[model samples]
Target: MRPTKGKLLGILAATFVGQMALQVGVIQDYWKKNYWSGQGFAESLSPDQTLLQLFGFREFLAGILWVRADSFFDEGNYDAVLPIIRLCTILDPKQIDIYATGMWHIAYNFTDEEQRSDRRYIPSALALGKEGSRQNPNTYELFFETGWIWYHKIDDDYHQSIKWFRQAQERVDMLPARRNLLANAYQRNNQVKEGLEHYWKLYAETAEQYEKQKDIYQLFQQKETLEQNLDTMIVRMVQRGWLAQERGEAGQRVYDTTEPFDVGFSARVIVDEPKVLRVQGTWNVLPVGTRIRIIVRDADNPNFTLAAMDWDGQNEVVLDPERDATFMQDQGFVKNRRFNKRIDMSKDPTMYPFARKSENYLVEFYYNPRSASLHVQDKFGWNGEGMTDKNFLRTDVRKEFEWIPGPKAGMFTEDWKLAERPTPPARIVYTALTLSRDQILRKGDWIDKTPMVQTSNFDASRFSVTTEDIIDVPTLRSSAPSPIAPGEVKKTGDNP
Candidate 1:
């Protein structure tokens, strides 16, 4: 019963198709069942890691290599997964979903749980994304992933944006959303020609969003520079205690949680003129409670104050409204978890005490708290280097008093837990200046517009800077404080 010519041809064609379909289905099923056994990935691990011991080598040998890469990557076997992923991609470059998902899992995982966390996966994801985009050139998702990896995971090179733009521009009908995304990448990387071209195309071609021309127009508006500077200044102020925000006004604050604590906020009393207060026989002229505004022209801001007292570490121990805790009224002082505002001094035993001269001290201030949001901690004894109170410090954060009483003279403080920590003196005393006008500028104006600094007949080394004398550096846009003459030091008796 031989079939006719047409029937025979059709029968043969059907048989061939059926056999090929069955073989492909069987191969896919086998791959699905054995691929992610976790052991095969162990074998493919690089020599550096020991994942094989954790996942098994028997299962690894029989598994599809691609699945091994994904599991190893998830397990933080960065070095191990790279080779496997590479091999898998080489074998099946056309597997679009695998290329996207597997590479992403390995490349973008950012964890440092044991210092063994694989933060280096971003590059692997980027490499796979790029390969996928090349293989599936018409696929918008591949190019989108590539652009994302390049824009975020890798160095955001402006030129790299062009590649993604080209991929999205393929003649194989692209989705409007993906089309717009390509335009955005172009703008981000500053691809002027392609960026503007697509932007306008988006405006004219479809009903997606045409008024977006304003976005393109505004993007070029020096707003980026302005925004960038705004970011930097916010960070700078936050570090200086002036600004308090998490992200520094958007992007300027590049937070490194691992960064060691620096003395961003401190009150440095510079002994510019050590001899000025004890001026030749003018002892009674300035009374005990005189408040003098302070300055450190060489330093950054108002966090530091210069107060003069007898050269003894035993200045009045006042209530530390910022740190000291109070259990009762006169019996117990309330401990302030945080105090941004400067408090006035009173007759409290913890009030201003005479800080010893001839020997200097630097007072370190920190902000992070164990429980509270606002805290002022001392950061001096943190590194375990030079400690004022060795036992009072935690391994991480500690505060210390830093100042050179002399060339090599350092003050040592005992970790005394008095009932109440002494509060700052009620008066502002100008013991000395940090930098003189001559030191800042021989001729031009300073960053501060206040009183120009000058050496005084107090004939002392450091000058007593009247609030007016402290001026800004002309270079930076700051107001100059009105000048106070050398002879007319503001008296506490005078209305401030």
Candidate 2:
């Protein structure tokens, strides 16, 4: 049957619309499988936004949303940024900056009134980063970002971090600075040999690049850092038996980790003035990089303490901004076997309001072997296995991340309890003390004579630190010998 002109035109228009819809569906399905599979299309965007995306304005929409998110961030409207970041990622998953920036904001920017990061957001940040990596698999930035989340934000999960960092390092686009993270992850995971190899390769590459282009001062600077790190690693490795027989090189001293190393770790805090503290301690470790983390906060405030990673993202935990807001934390480097730091909370009234007068204050000192220098870890094995303290010795069993190396370095067993298990990582040794409000805020200056083990006298003046000291690596040797003599055992004196 022959149709009229209007009817024929309408029929053609309908057929065209249907064909277009089918093509759009096919394209979207392809995109969903290959990229932006993080969220369902309808779930992530409104009708108008979806229509805009249909017109190939996905990146445009993403940029606009990211700008809006940045505005929200600048305004301190952090809650509003989360949904925007989610939308932006779904809109344009390939925007590496959005993923990196959004992940950082989610992981670190969401803090409480006390400035402690809301750990609940960490899972979201990690999820977002992983999704971005899935979308942009060829890029190195998102991989690096995800690695950093695990490396730093997720409580020394070097095993987990190394996977992402290694992936990032393999990519040709990875920045030179980002490459160090992979090396660091290797060392932190107790893969000292692998870490040293990576450092040397990276340094050689940087030197070659600098030789090619002498105008790039940053490369030279990078080479210097690489050299320093190399020196430290070499020294630590030699001292700890990791580099025992490097062909033709013998007579190297390797310390025995089976024997306990008495760090003689003791810490005391004295209030020098209103809202000011003098924290002094002796770790008796000769490593220059060992640091004591000191935290001063309201006794009732638990947020000041480092919390384990919350992998359970089923219910997002929100932080209360109003309650327990005052907190101060500083890390003091152990120099000459001693750590001393003057913490003045008098400044930044907004940060350290000291609002709770009636409540007691807690002063904590932490020496996590995970965070200490490799040289320090030579005496105190990872998880403080070989460390002993007379007074403030603590023991706690923590989950160990076991990873199979080679091509499957990142893969882990579904069940952490493997049939043939290695020694369960144990004992996170640290130190702490508490004080009444009167003692912290009102008491005058006084020295705290706490019963702490004092190591045998080692002349610290003979050993001095210098930039050139790195050149004299072999000369350093075990000159700053063990805190306790080989025959002497530290007295744990009957202090219950």
Among the numbered candidates, top TM-score falls to: 2
lDDT of 2 by residue, 1-496 (tens): 8889999999999999999898797877787665543434555456875565554677798888889988988999988987787677767767889889988987788654435564545767776776677667777888899889888876465677877787778678988887987888877766667788999999999999999999999999999999999998788666554455345343445354445677766665667776677777766665477777666667665333432323324122122233335656567776555666677766555556677754676677666677666556776655565577776666452445544445443322122222222544545556557676656556443234222212234223323322222211223444743343322233332110
Over 275-335, each residue of candidate 1 has an lDDT whose tens digit, in order, gives 1111111111111121112211112222222221111221211111211210000000111
What's the lDDT for residue 150 in model 2?
86
lDDT per model vs. reference? 0.35, 0.64
Candidate 2 lDDT (Cα, whole model)?
A: 0.64
Structural similarity to truth (TM-score) of each candidate = 0.29, 0.58
The per-prediction tally of clashing pairs is 61, 0
